[model samples]
Structures are given as C-alpha cells and as structure tokens.
Target: MVFEYAPAPESRSAVDIAPSYGLFVDGEFTEAAGGRTFTTVSPSTEEVLSEVALGGAEDVDRAVRAAGRAFEKWSALPGRERAKYLFRIARILQERSRELAVLETLDNGKPIRETRDVDLPQVAAHFFYYAGWADKLEHAGFGPDPRPLGVAGQVIPWNFPLLMLAWKVAPALAAGNTVVLKPAETTPLSALFFADVCRRAGLPRGVVNIVTGAGETGAELVAHPGVAKVAFTGSTGVGRSIARSVAGTDKKLTLELGGKGANIVFDDAPVDQAVEGIVNGIFFNQGHVCCAGSRLLVQESVHDEVLDALRRRMELLRVGDPLDKNTDIGAVNSAEQLERIRSLADAGEAEGAQRWAPACELPERGYWFAPTLFTGVTQAHRIAREEVFGPVLSVLTFRTPDEAVAKANNTPYGLSAGVWTEKGSRILWMADRLRAGVVWANTFNKFDPTSPFGGYKESGFGREGGRHGLEAYLDV
Candidate 1:
C-alpha cells in the first residue's frame, strides 16, 4: 500500500537570501571572528546559493569554550531533563519539516521525495529514539552512572545534512554532553536552521553551537584542547587527519568515513528483489552515499540475466530538478564532484572496460550525471579499486564463495557489503567471512535507529546507531 503524507506549502517565491555567513555561538548568530565570508553555490544550477561565514581557528576556539561552559551545567542535569530538551527539538523538527526539506534540496541538490520522506522522517525518528534512552543508561549495558564527555566537536558531511546533524547532536545531548557541531562548508544552511529549531525548543544557550567553515575550521575544532570528544563523517583521507590530530588528546573520537561496498548475488536469489536492493544501494541519493555498493559481484551462472534486468531498470530512472517528487537521480553534489566522477569513468574506459549509461538528457544548468555502469572491470582497473561516490557501478563475476569474499575484501575500505542468496547456510557463511562492518543478506543499505552503523579498518571506526552510540560520548 502506498502511503500519503500531508503536503506543505512550496517555497518557490524568492525570499531575499539572508547574508548566509554567520556563526551560531553562545545562543546567538554572529559574524565570523575574522570578518570573512565565502560564497556557497547551488550544485543543481551552479548559481550562488548564498554567502556563508568562513570561520577561522579562533572562531572554533570560541565555539568550543561556549560548549565547554555549557557542558559544566548540562552534564550535571538529570538524564530525564536532558531527554526533555531532545524531545522538544524533535517536535520542532517535525513542525518545520517542509522548510528544512526544501532547504536541503536547494543546498544539497538531493531529490525532494527523498529529503522530505526519507531524510526528514528518519531525522525525527533518530532524535525520538535516542531521547528515550537518556534516562535508561543503566539498562543500556554501559554500566551504572555512565558519564558524559564535557564538550563534543562534531563535523558532518554534505550528503544528508540535517539528518547527520540530528544523528550527531541528538545522542550527544541525550547522553548529557554539549556540542559544537560543524556542517560541511557547502551545506551549512540546514545546520543553521537546526540552530533555530533548538532555540525555538528553548534548549539551553550554548548547549549546541554550530560553527561554519571548511577544512581548516574542522582541523581547528579537532585540535582544540577544550573539546572532550570528536565525531566526524566524511572521506577516509580527512578521517586519517582527524585521527592524527586527536592521537594524544584525552578526547574520545568516532569517525565514519568512505566505503566501496560489494553487492553479491547468488544464482538462487530472488532476482526482482535483488534488483531493487541493487538500485537502492548505489543509485539512491545520486550515489553520494558513503556505503554505496559500487562493486557488483554476481555468481557466474546468473551473471548475464541479472545484468540485463539491472540495465532495464537503469533506463527507467528519472533525472531532473531536485524539487520534483518524481526525480529518481538528482545532480552530483557539485561541479568538482561531477568532474571527479567523469575522470574516474574515463579511467574505467581507458583501462579496457566497457562503459554504458542510460540515454537521458540532463538539464543544461545543473551538475548532472546519468546512472552509469562499467562491465568487464577487472581488479586492476582504477574504477574497481577506488570510491567513485557517484551514480556509477562496476560489474564483475565470481565462480566460488571464497573468490567472492576475497574480491569483496580487496579494497582498503570495510564499511559495508551485501549478499543475495536463498540458502540460509551461505548467508551465514558469507556474513562471517565478509570483512565489513554492516553486512546485508538479500538486502542493501538498510538503516534503523536500533542498528549500529559504522566501518572497520580504513573505512573508519566507532558505531553511530543503536545503544552503542552512547559509547562515543560517554566516559566508560
């Protein structure tokens, strides 16, 4: 049965774009300490989205200090009281859900259907779930009287802006810690709007501060001595830098980084369901997903049949304005990202692989790339080895389960992997051998507030969901 939700008033009329540059610090929004700002562009049309504050190292210090001061009192609050603030913030998010969705689509260029239905609802669910756990830490297996880190430094990625904010901030607050969160430089709007939501919820001043800037600002936040915890979700290279910066510090750290996951198919699997899972694993969110299943490993017997079905499905994908509910694939996050995807695709072709894309016309204004596939990709090809992070897939075949496992674990990343098989024994067998944090049997990219999601090895560490999330913010 199809589910219908209430419609919201559209935001088509051009409101005067605010001077997008400002820091949310100490219960107020203020200009950057160095009085500098930078232009933010809409990835869809390459138009100037707005000017955002370019915060400096000093600005980060100020944000951290504010969080630290707030933490002293916040940590002393009863867990039930802390949970009340989180519940209030969740309610406000639900009230302003449409506005936030539209802002996310405009800034991040994701499909409206996804931002509205998938991202926003999950964002609220995350807060609500974590809020309920606030006063129940004793039963959460964290031992008696778990303690909160004083102040948390959280940096999120561009893919799911508001949702990532909710994921990082919700649990931190629920666990009795204050946070100075930083959104990606390109997608700071939702984080700023989230600050407004916190204010409307009457959350305590300095309990959650948002400072906007690029890599330098993030480096400063991680390196600052006052921050008691650091949580980041982005590329693996940046995760390494953060790990190094926090090496000797007493702060707790959690990193959610890059992924090049495998979606394996056995001959007895249900083909139609597997096809849907494959589409969702990579193409959903325009393949900007960190846990995107870029590698398709099909058992040698049904390889041809599965590829044919996937090709037909790929042709039906709709690519257009992100605001359209019908859009299936939206623009690449930015021109830089489009170029990166294009370059890697070129490498695939140059390295003797067959490349194919659906015959679809993209809007001339936005940064768009059609859903793409490269078959005949060997392990040596750059496309097979690297994280494309776009609407691209590399197809390969394997003869045995051992070969499948070996090929799947070839990459340095161990974030996620999927298996499609009718045999229960094989499912358990593969799950045990797969060197990934999240393993899906007959499914891919499934998320739950109760499931712990993170990576292993170079993909990054520390779980983000489930009762385990409190570990990152607590003194265990």
Candidate 2:
C-alpha cells in the first residue's frame, strides 16, 4: 500500500520551528557568542529547516562553568525536591508531546507514527520512572550513602533525538547533578524544545545547558575539566576516540555505541510471527537503530523458504514522507548518512553478495534509500561484518545452535540479538551464548524505562534505561 498522509494515529500536530536556533545556556536561549551559525536541513526535502548556532570551545567553557555553578546548589537540594522537578518536566513533555513528535519527524525523517507512538511515549516514561528514583537512592543498592556526580556532560545521537535527551537528563537530574547536553547537529529542534520544557518546569537557572553544533563542540564538552561525568551515544569509531579523549581524566564516562545485531530464526519458530519480527528487526527507524538486527541467521533447512517470505514482505513496506501516517520507513537522517549507506551497498555488490531492493521510487529531493537486502552474504563479506546504519540487511544460514552462536558472536559489536524459537530451553541456551547486552527472545526493539538497555563489547559501555541508569550519575 502507498503511504498516505492521513491524520496522525495519535492525532499529533506539526510544530513550527524558529528561523534561527540559539544556544540554551543558563536557562535562556541566546545567540552564539561569536555569532557563528550553521544551517540544519530537512532530510525529507533537502531544504534548510533552520539556522542553528555553531558553538565553539569558548561557548563550551561558558556552559561548563554554568553547569558547575548550578551543580553546587542543585546537588545540595534534597532528592525529594529534585523529584518534584522531574515530575514537572514529565508533565510538560506530555502536554506538548504532539508538537515534539512532529518536530522529531520533521527533523529526524522517521515515521510520524513511530515518533508519536514510540519515541514520545518513551520520552515521557523515562522521566516518570527516573522521577521516583530521586529520593530512593539509599535503597537502590549503590551503597549506604550515594552522592551525586557534580556536573554531567551528555552527547546524544541523531537517531532518537528527544528520547535520548530524556534518557540522559532525567537520570542525571534525579541524581541531583546539573547537565550540559549536546544534541546532534542534524536534529536539534526537539532538544531545543526540551530546553524550553526545562525552563517551564521551573528548573533552576543553569541546571541544564543545551549547546548545538558539530563534532568540534562535542569534543569541547567531553574534554571540559569542570564536568564530573560524561555520557555519550553514537558510532563505535567515535566512541573509541571519546574513550581515548577522556583517558587519564578524573571524569566518570559511559559510552553507548554501534552494533551489528543478529536475528536468529530456528526451524521450529513461528513462520509468520518470525517474519514480522524480521521486518521490524532491521527496517524500523530506517535501520538507524544501534540495536537493529542487521544480520539474519536462519536455520539452513528453512533458509530458502524464509528468504522468499522475507522478500515478499519487504515489497509491502511503504517508504516515503516521514510525516505520513502509513510510512514504514523514511529517509536517512542526513545527506552524509545516505552517501555512507550507498557506498556500503556498492561495496556489498562488488564483494559478491546478491543485493535486492523493492521496486520503489525514491523521492527526488530528499536523501532516501529503499529497504534493501543482501543474500549469499558470507562471514567474510564486509557488509556482513560492518554496521551498515541503513535499511539494508544481510542474510546467512546456520546448521545448528552452535553455528548460530558462532556467527552471531563473530562481530566486534555485541549490542543486541533476537532468537525466534518455540522451545523454552533453546531460547535460554541461545540467550546465554549470545554476548550481546540485550537478548530479545520473541520481541525486538522494545524499550521500557523499567527495563535496562545497553550493549556489550564495542557496542559501548553503560546502561541507559531503568533504575540502573542512576548509576551513571551517582558517585558510589
């Protein structure tokens, strides 16, 4: 079915963005100190969305100092008081959830359905869950007495802009720490709106500072000596560099990075349910998800049958305008990301993998790529080994549970994996052997504030959601 732009299922409306973006510093939005600004374009139309301030090291220093100053008083406030602040923020997020969802879709190029139903709900839920934790730290198993880390520097990715901000900030504030956050340069609108939420929540001035720019600004924030802790979620390559950048510093760091997750289907698995899971495993969010199941390991006996079914299912996925209520997949986040995906697809064909894409017309202006698949991919193939952060998936076969385990654990990333089987014993056995941080037995890509989420190995360190999330902000 063609994706139609009907009313949002949740009845969310689009938000109007300011012509120019400003720095949210010390509780107010201000122009860049040097008046240097850059444009943010919509990936759906390839048109400039707004001009955002380009913050430099000097701006970073100012934000850090403001955060440090706020930390002195914020940390001294009782946990119950901090909990009230979080609850207020949560209420504001719900009140303006529709506006935030639309801005998220406009800026990030994800389906309005997902932004409304998935991301926005989780964004509010994260704050709600963390709010209850603010005063319960002593009972949280950290120690007899847990203290807040002074100031936290948080860097979030372009995939889930507002959701990631909520994940990083809610826990830090609940732990009684002030924050300096940097949203991805491509998708800064929702985060900017979030900064407004903080202001409306009556959070103390300088408690949260949002600086928008590219990698240079991020490096400045991560390297700032005044920050007591750092939390980052991005590419594995960049995560390694961040690890090195913070080395020898006294800052506490939590890194959440890339993944090449495996989705294993056993011969005894439910065929229709497994196929639906397979579609959602890799295609959801245009395959930009760090926990996306990019590698498909099927039981050899049913390999050909499953591949045919998967291909037929892929044909039905609607790819187009993210604002459409029916779109299953949308444009990549940016032009640069589209180019990277195209380059990797080219290399996959050159490396002898059979590539397949549904017969679909890509939009003329925006950076869009069809939902693609590569078959006969070997363990040695680059596409099978690397994290292709696009709507492209690789297919491989396994003869036994042991072989499935081996192939699943082959990559440097251990973020997440899916096991589809009817047998209870096999599910547990497979879950144990897979080295990923998250193992989805019958479900894939489910997020809850009550559940712990993170990755193992090069997928990065630190958990994001759940009670354990407080650990990142607390000095035990």
Candidate 3:
C-alpha cells in the first residue's frame, strides 16, 4: 500500500495582503503617473493576490530622481550610523519573517519550507551581514577610503524575490549608495512589504525606492542618466542588453545571469548522498534557480547505478501546493513558465532522449509540472544546451574525470557546478578545473552570506555576496 501524507497547509492569515500596492518613491507609496496597474496572483491557487501599480518611464524617472536627491545625505552619514539603520532592518525582518515567508510562498509559488527556511533566513542574514560591513568599509581591503557610487539602479528576478532584494539592497546600502530597485513583474509583493520594513526602521526618505513594472520599466531605470551604477540579476539576454545600454557611459554595471550548471557524479561517490544532492541541485525552488544544476553528468562506469537511485528518489518527492509544509515540489511560478518547461521537455523527447517522470497527482487549479529527467541526452540536444529554469534535468555520461570536466565547462554559462566524490584530492582537482563561479564537492545548493557568488564568461560578470559584493557599489 502507498502511504500518503495528511493535508497540512500553512495558514495564510500570517500576512495581510493589501487590496492594491503603489510604486514606492521618496519613502512613500504613490500611484503611477500613467495610472496603469497589473494583477499579481497566487500561482499555487490561481487566485488574484493584489493589483500592483505598473511603473512607466515617468515613474522610473521619479524614483531615480528621489534616489539621486537622497544620495547626498545618505552618503554623508557616518558609517556607524548607516550600520544602525541596517541593523534595525535586519531585526525587523527577523521579527516579521513568518509573515514575509507566507507572502513570498503565495507570490512566488515556492514550497513553504523553502520560503520559510531558505529564503526568509537568507534575507535577514544578508541584511545582518552587510550591516556589520557598513561601519568597517574603510578597512575592507578596498584601500583606506572606499567611496560610494551616488545612486544604484538594481533589477532582480522572480525566482527568489525577497532574498534577491536583500542581495542587491543590503550591500548597496552598506556601501553608502542610495538605490532605485525594480522587482520582477510577476513577484512584487515582498518588495512592497519590504518598503514597509524600511519605513518602520525609520530609513531616510528617498534612500531606497521601488518602481514596479515589466521589462520597459526596468529598461528606463537602467538607462536613466541619474543612476551612477547598475546591478541586474536576470536572464543573459536581458543582461547583455543592459551591458550594451550602459556601454560608452560612466555607469558602473554588474550582472548575475542564467546558467545551465552541471552536477557530476563519479563512480567513487557516496551513492545515497549523491542522489540527495542531485535532487536538491535541480529540484530546489522548482528548479527556478539561476545557478541550478540542470545538467547531470555521471561517470559511464556507474551510470546505471546512479540513474536507478535517482529514479527511486524522484518517486518519493511530493509535488503539490506551495503552502503545504510536506510538499517537496511546488507549482511553477506562472502559466508562462509552465509552458516554457513543457516546450523544452517536449523537445527533449523529439530529439530522441528518454524522458522520465514519476506517477504523481497534480492540482488542477494552478501551474504544475511533474519533476522530469531526460536520459540519452547528447551535448547538441536543445534540452542539454538550454536553460530550462524549471524542475527538469538532462542526464549525460562520461568515461573519465577529464571527459567530465570537458563536458561540464562546455557550456556558455559558468554560474555553478557540482562534483560528487569521496576523494578530497579529486574534489580539489575538479574544482580547480571547472570554470564555474561556485563548485560543490559533495553537497549542492549550499549558500552563505560570506561566500562570494557570481558567474564568468557569458553567465555575466561581478559578484553578489561577501566583501567582494561591496566593490560593485563602491567607487573603488
């Protein structure tokens, strides 16, 4: 008999959703000048969450002007004083973490466990980590006196909305730059909620502004003359466009873009542990991660062994509502994303790859895709080469360590990779050879505030965490 879990849903009452949200500029929530609005929905239930004001070029200009105006006072404040404000923000985030997590799960459709444990904690930790750096930037190895860029224009993706906000805003503020930030169109509620946190922390008016809209609004912010710096975390296509838009200009720019990360398993790897790592690497956040290990490379000698174990593990994953604490995989963030995953998976089958997914029931009301994998994939297949950005894995096999390294670094992206082996020396050897920004020896999806995370080559440039993250915002 198959065992089933009892329904356990996290209470949505933890958060009070507003009927409508406005663009946050000059420390106030104001309606867009164009009077445009868009509805945000709960992807888990297809219920309308709220209507958010759609920012236009005018709104972007207003936000950039506000950030520029606030830069003078904000940059002149003592580092210790600036640190105090960040500390308050961190404490407030901790105090209200449950509320933020519930709201994030509702908006982003990530599992409640991830929104609560991974996203919310990282958001608060990022603030706390950067808070300490604010008072110590002078001694931070960037010379005796690192200066702040006047104003930073930032754009973050929808995958990890609030955590990405923390990644951008925390370091920018710690470096003493004011900011005009744009959260992704699909997930703007947490950013709106964070504006409330800033108000509660008594943050200076205009120090941070959120202008909400789609690509056009983000383009305006990136191209705005008042912005002294630009930080973007999104698709490589968009990142390349921003790089060109800021070309021949004085704007300091940084981008954290997409990846088709490789998770390689060797014959000597701990089979059980490697299976778990493989699952987490690709399936975490419904695989809506920029650095997700979407490609699995196994040693040909142990290919069958690892594949069998992986199939067994995939069968055990519970896929369903984001609010259910027991859910292992949740709904795709939107209908558009579901369609993308479907198209890519279909291509895998048409290209003569073997596709596999466990028997799992899906809710009818929301965007859902079963956890899927494709074997017999070649390097030239679209599924193997492209970034699906969903819960789909492409499996390949190699005969030797050198072949594995060659296959891993064959992609245009170099965001992250994983090597599963018991030999410490082999792990170091593989790590040194991989071109990725981050490499996990045995584990996967591990993150910390102190570690620097970013990509190389076409994956985009500049780091987003640790002391290195500060350099992007400073006038070093």
Best by TM-score: 3
All models, RMSD in angstroms? 3.0, 1.8, 0.8
- What tens-digit string does per-residue lDDT give for candidate 1 at 1-476? 96533334346442235756589999999999899998877788888878888889989988988998898888888889988988988898898788888888888999988988899999999999999999997778887878897899999999999989988888899899999998998889889888888999888899999999999999999899999899999999999999988898798999999999999999999999999999999999999999999999999999999999999999888888887777888888888889999999999999999999989989999899999999999999999999999999999999999999999999999999999999999999999999999999888877888889999988999999889988898888
TM-score of model 2 (CA atoms): 0.97
Report the lDDT tens digits of candidate 3 across residue range 179-231: 99999999999999999999999999999999999999999999999999999
lDDT of 1: 0.90
Task: Give the alpha carbon lDDT tens digit for every residue of 1-476 in model 2.
Answer: 87554644433335778899799999989888889999888898888889999998889899999998898899999889999999999999999888988888888999988998999999999899999999999988899799998889999999999999999999999999999999999998898999889989999999999999999999999999998899999999889999999999999999999999999999999888899999999999999999999999999999988888998999888888888788899889998999999999999999999999999988898989999999989999989998899999999999999999999999999999999999999999999899999999987998899888898899988888887898988999
Model 3 pairs whose backbones collide: none
Clashes of 1: 1
Query: For every model shown, what is its TM-score relative to the native structure?
Result: 0.96, 0.97, 0.99
Residue-level lDDT for 454 in candidate 2: 92
Deviation of model 2 at 379, angstroms? 0.6
Q: Is candidate 1 or candidate 3 better by lDDT?
A: 3
Candidate 2 clashing pairs, residues 3+ apart or interchain: none
lDDT of each: 0.90, 0.91, 0.95
Which candidate number maximizes lDDT? 3
TM-score of 3: 0.99
